[model samples]
Target: MSAQHFVFLLVKNHTHLTLACATEPLRIANMISGQELYRWSYASEDGVSATASNGSVTLVQHGFGALPPCERLFVIPGLGMTDFITAPLLACLRRAKAGGVAVGALCSGAWILAEAGFLDGMKAAIHWEYHDAFAERFPDVALVRSVFVADERHITASGGTATADLMLHLIEQDHGYDLSIAVSDMMVYAGAREATGEQRISLQSRHGMRNPHVARAIAIMRGALEEPVPPGSIAEDLGISVRQLERLFGRYFNTSPSRYYMELRLDRARNLLLQTEMSVSEIAVACGFQSLGHFARLYRKHFGGPPSSQRGRIA
Candidate 1:
């Protein structure tokens, strides 16, 4: 079979780690198979170099308008993705889709695909950090918590090593399981997860121990962030008393149930503040704060500054 061609459009501030993870698997596959299984190139908004978020610069072979025909085009964007979405880039993507080229995204590049209207009514996987804002902004898109989504014409990975997983899945589909395993073994990546694998660690693993009551209560808290359920309500849902909930929180988290819930809401508010273009007041309301003044005071007390001070900070 002919080699599959892939083009990576690296927007400014793109994550460097994800780019390496995406392309390295292909290179290793080719080396292992003793064949040119895949060919790849780079592009940028400008016809020159694209600088990554970590200050590395990649000299690209094409600009957006001059992108070469390829089997797939993967957009690699990172923090401040909104600032990099432009008319030329969107037009290029639209043209590619119109021409029947498969499109995909790495990291926060799902934002670009969503902005270009490629993800409407399609399931996608974006970096877990973008989950809150991406859902709020693009209600039409069905966002899954998986590492990658490949069932549709347009593919997306949650970034980081997830891109590598997606590439391995493609390799397995195009070649065979043996070649994919060879490539993975060569990379020393033993824990490469499948598409249905979730992006974030489970609450149980994160805490290093399992407690069903704590887990259930935290799940309730997370689900009701926008209209936070009271600790008593969460306890009732778990069929436990409020005192038991408080004792659980104090034992496992070293905090009270109310404080734990407040911290959860504030952390989400912080994520929205840094990740989205939402105003502080809008974020406060979205995070279940009815009084802007009260929210600001609590935010300052928790984070050592007001919510407005968090604007433009890198996530």
Candidate 2:
């Protein structure tokens, strides 16, 4: 079979994990199959290098001014994605689509594709962290909460290991199940996750709480992490008395509503500390803790270290 060429357009601060997961599958497939089944290259805006969120850099072989024809062109973006979606980037994607190339996005790369109008009127997936903002920005795009979306013309993955799932699906589509499985085994990947798999764990799965009211309450808390609603207000919204809500929480979670809310916010703060470059104070405010001193105390108690220390370890 002829090699199916894939070109990845790397934007500044692209997620390193997503880029590796997207390309490594193809490389392993070729090794396992003993054929040049896939060919890939990287591109940037001006033939320069692109840096990832983790501070690593990738050198590009092509620029938007000289995009190579390929079976697919993926826009791989990460932090500050809005700043990278310049007019030239959008035009390059548009031109690729017009020239009959399949256009795709990995992670926040969907933001650029949507800006280029490629995802308009189509179902798409992006990194869960960007979902709320992406939905607000691209109202015309039907955003799904899946790990990835493989629509007829537009392909998208929610980033991270989900990019591997998308690539395995494509391998299965092109070759067969056995070869895809072989490639997955070679990479020690736990088989292929369906495109329909969710990017975020459901509340019930996360907390093992099954009661309907408890589930609804937890969902509300997650949605309002930055500005938590009072427990009484949550009970009121659910048309239940505060006592009933408290009983439900104690029954399922064995904790008070306010405590549970604090845990949720703390969990989010921990993730931001590890995965993003947000300052401790900024993360505290974003996670609904107004007092920096108070936030530091709670964070140390919960995570066994200060938020700044966690960020330092990650760095």
Candidate 3:
């Protein structure tokens, strides 16, 4: 079989270590085998040298202006992608997609790609810290906070070690298990994980409320974020008085139930703004607001801007 090939896209303020974690495995795999199992080159926008978040810079072999044909093009943008989404970059991505270049992303690069209209209707895994914003802005794109995604032609992943895992999966796919294991052993990785390993913190523990009643109430509230139930109703359904409900929230979270519910709605709204392409009116309606004016006012009061403006700046 021919050697697997890739083109890695780097950007300013990228996580340099993550880049090494991703590409070094391929190098090790090639070293282990007697043939060229993998080959790759680095590329950047405008063909300029790319810098990492930690102040290191690397000169690439070619710029996005004149990329070499490769099996895959993995975009590895990091912080400040909100500023990185330019007409030229987006046009380059569009051209690449049109030219049949299989595309992928890492870290906030997913945000950049979606802004360039590459991720519509596709399920993506992105850095969890950006999930709220990503999901909020790109509702059409299914957002899974996992290590990586490889179900179809695209292969986006979250941050840091997730990049390593994605590369290991690629190695395993190109070579067999033995070569993959050898490469993994060369790096001293504990072991290769199945693709579904956890990417973000699990919800079962975030609640910290072992009381089933409180858990049920919180879950219900999360599910019904748009049309929030009155805290009193929640207490009543949980077979507790309003005072008791207040005591539970106070004990567990040091806050009021109404406040908790309000925060949850706003949080959901924030995510919609950053991740989905839904209009502000649509997001407000989905989050349970009947009055667009009221939703905009409240959103401004909570997040320092109206929903539309926030999504515009971020997405």
Each candidate: RMSD to true structure?
1.6, 5.8, 4.6
lDDT of each residue in 1-315, candidate 2, tens digit only:
799999999998889999999999999999988999999999988888888989998888998878987999999988878777787788888899889999999998888888877778999998877764565568899998999999647999989999999999999999999988988998888746898988888778887756789888888998899999999999999999999999998988799999999998998887777655667888898889999999999999998988888773222
lDDT of 1 by residue, 97-155 (tens): 99889999989888899998889999999999888889889999999999999998899
List where candidate 3 sits over 4 angstroms from the true fold.
191-193, 205-220, 229-259, 266-315
For all candidates in order, the CA lDDT equals 0.92, 0.87, 0.79
Candidate 2: Cα lDDT at 205: 87
Where is model 2 more than 4 Å wrong at Cα? 210-213, 216-246, 253-315
TM-score of each: 0.94, 0.74, 0.75
The RMSD (Cα, Å) of candidate 3 is 4.6
List model 3 lDDT by residue over 277-309, tens digit each. Answer: 678888888788899999888888988877777
Error of 1 at 24 (Å): 0.9
Model 1 error, position 128 (Å): 2.5
Residue 183 lDDT, candidate 3, scale 0-100:
82
- A best-first ranking of the candidates according to their TM-score comes to 1, 3, 2
Which residue segments of model 1 deviate by more than 4 Å?
313-315
